[model samples]
Target: MNYFVFGGSGFIGTHLINLLSKKYPNSVVYNLDIKENKQNGKAIYINCDVRKSIELDVPITSNDIVINLAAVHTTPGHPDHEYFETNILGAENVTAFAERHNVKKLLFTSSIAPYGASEEMKTEITLPMPNTPYGISKLVAEKIHMIWQIKKNTERQLTIVRPGVVFGKGENGNFTRLYWGIKKHRFFYPGRKDTIKASIYVKELVNFMLYRIEMDKTDVEIYNCTYEPAFTIEEISNAMMKATGMKRTIYKIPGGALKFAAGVIGALGGKSFGIHPDRVKKLMISTNISGKKLKDSGYKFQYSFDEALKDWYKDNDNLYLK
Candidate 1:
């Protein structure tokens, strides 16, 4: 088997590559990213950008599985246009390319951002009303994939997965922010600490993606890829503090102050959250996505949130604030 993954160098993509390579030992897997290839594999890296309808130089045939994972991931500094271009337009290009090449299957890595925030829990049944350009772009990407598959009568199967916040070893993105802040003993609890948020470890999510591609019978399905257990910010913080033996100087601040400060600091650095703004927002909002569909489809996750934080601390004991 041959597999092609776009945006392969990113954390989730890398995890996918590692998992696929192990599962299909005889298969060839290629990782495509805009950056120059600095990877090795049964698994090779192809430096390609998905922003345009450019033909992949890799020899794609009917048997190959194309996983579109590329995007301008959510960051405070990323311009809205950049998000739309890279997330929506880039998805367009990937779908177009998939159709052109007659790939056997196209799996898109979308996000829970498509569902937006809620005071209540979000499930696959919830209507997607994305709040940010990032979320809008992801929702658009899902629509594009659906439209292309429907209009073309393409034989290629499509699977869309909207994963909650994912974290694991070699973690980047939002998880890294939390990890670094806790490691430095500089993090604080904000708003109500009981705000429930869902997550999946990188390995668990990628494994499920592969499972759906290989075994699931549903056609053109979308699954909320997350863990069975949801956790509150305070619970997660306590877990990290226990695992790392770090002091939790987490002062609960008003949610209004956090929002106001995030705006101010976001403008200044365009990136750094002055007070870990991202974490503050996450702790106030209930963004816990359900994984019932995946479970119903006969899949189980190996890593719990506690296990994830413990492993992170174990691996980086030297980096702890102490």
Candidate 2:
């Protein structure tokens, strides 16, 4: 089967492409992205932005599968309008391409952000109440994909995955920030160390996506892609310390004080320390998302947090201090 990935240069996309190439040596894979990066020799790369209309030189047919992974997803990174421009508009263009080519299946990588910042455990049954522009835009994109599925009726299969914070070797997001802090021996507990942080290792997430597609499940199926029994901040820190063999003096600070400091830092346009009000606020909220749907479907997660951390450290030894 041919695989067409919209955003095939990003961290998750890169891992997915490599996995597909290794697993299915004979299958053809096409990557469409704005930037060109070194990819597996088996995959073809095409420079195209999903924000505008997507016109691929290769012929896409009903036998092929389309995976939409492109989006402006970094929070507090892009302006509000930019999220809508890339996510919403990008979804439209990708869906149009699938419709035009009559692709048999389309898989989308949405985010848990659409569940909004909440202390409650979120599942597939929970109603989306997205507050941030990124979250709102992702929810809208999911709806657009659903519309296409409904239009296609039984001819097309749609799978929507709302992944939590995904982390791996190439990641430079929240988890990476934590790793850097721990490596420097300056890591601290922002508030309650017991606050839950939902996450999935990049490899496990990619594996799950492939498993679902191979199952050939018909119609629309949505799953929150995170490991079961989400890890607490303290547990995550302990795991990282164990994995890297670098134990630090973990300090505890009051939530209110941290918020005030973050506010001052934000006012000063200070992102030097990676501590801003928005980030601090997010840290305080518990993202206790559930992957019960995926679990109930008889899918077993391959890597635990400890295993993932070990793999990350093994791959990027330079990130740690000597």
Candidate 3:
């Protein structure tokens, strides 16, 4: 069977493509994206922009697997319209393309943003109360794919993975920024240390997705993809310190003072400092998620939080971002 990955040039898609190539050596793998898959040259590239009707000239069959990873996910990074334009439209287009090809299996990478900001653990069954444009768009996109799944219920298989803060090599987001801050000793805890940031390593996140897809029993699968008992800020920071051997003390900065300092620095530095009041606010907010569903399914994660950080450290020459 052939494998098709939309937005496969991205961080998670790159890893998934690399893994697919190794695991299914004889099968054809197609990477369709607005940008080319420069890292995985083996994936047959297709210039695809899912915001509009997707037109593919590839030789795909009903037996092929289609994975949609295209979306504008970064919060405060894009205009509100950009999220809907890319996420909602991309979902519509991708599902429509899958329908046209009669593709049976499709996977979509969603986010825990649908749960909004929560200190309580959110599961797959949690009622989505998306607050941000990104979260709302993703929730809508999930329903869009779900509609596709139920339409061809007997034949179609859809798995939606809602991951929280996925980080590893090639990731340029939260964890990477944290890594740099820690390395340079600029990292400081803001007010509290108990802020839970639910997360899963990229390798483990993809591993869980593949595991769900490979199950013999065919069923509509949707689950929150995160480690159980999600790490607190202090826990995450200590793990990073242990991984990189950067054992300097992390000072706890007062919340109000830090916010004022960040605003001042950002005003002067003008985006170079990477310290914004909004960013500080985001850091303090907990994104607690539950993995009980996956765990209940007898799927074993390959990495613990500490081990995941350690593996990431090894992969990036001891500093995961570099």
CA lDDT, every prediction?
A: 0.76, 0.86, 0.86
Report the number of clashing residue pairs per model: 1, 0, 0
Candidate 1 lDDT, 119-166, residue by residue in tens: 777778899988988899899989999876676454557889988878
Q: Scored by Cα lDDT, where does model 2 land?
A: 0.86
Question: Candidate 2 has which clashing residue pairs, if any?
Answer: none
Per residue, candidate 2 scores C-alpha lDDT tens digits across 1-96 of 799988989988989999999898898998899997685456799988998888888776788989999999998889999999999999999999
Off by over 4 Å in 2: 39-41, 263-270, 318-322
Q: Which of candidates 1 and 2 reaches a greater lDDT?
A: 2
Which is the winner by lDDT between candidate 1 and candidate 3?
A: 3
Query: How well is each residue in 1-322 modelled by candidate 3, as lDDT tens digits?
Result: 9988988999999999998998889989888899996898779988889998988776878988899999898776899999999999999999999999998889999999888886677888889898999999999999999999999788878999998889998898889888888877777888989999988899998777777777654458888888887888888888888888887888998888888888988878757556778778888889888878877878888888888888888897864554
Worst 10 contiguous positions by lDDT, candidate 3: 210-219
Question: Can you give the TM-score per candidate against the true fold?
Answer: 0.89, 0.95, 0.97
The number of residue pairs in model 2 that clash at the backbone is 0
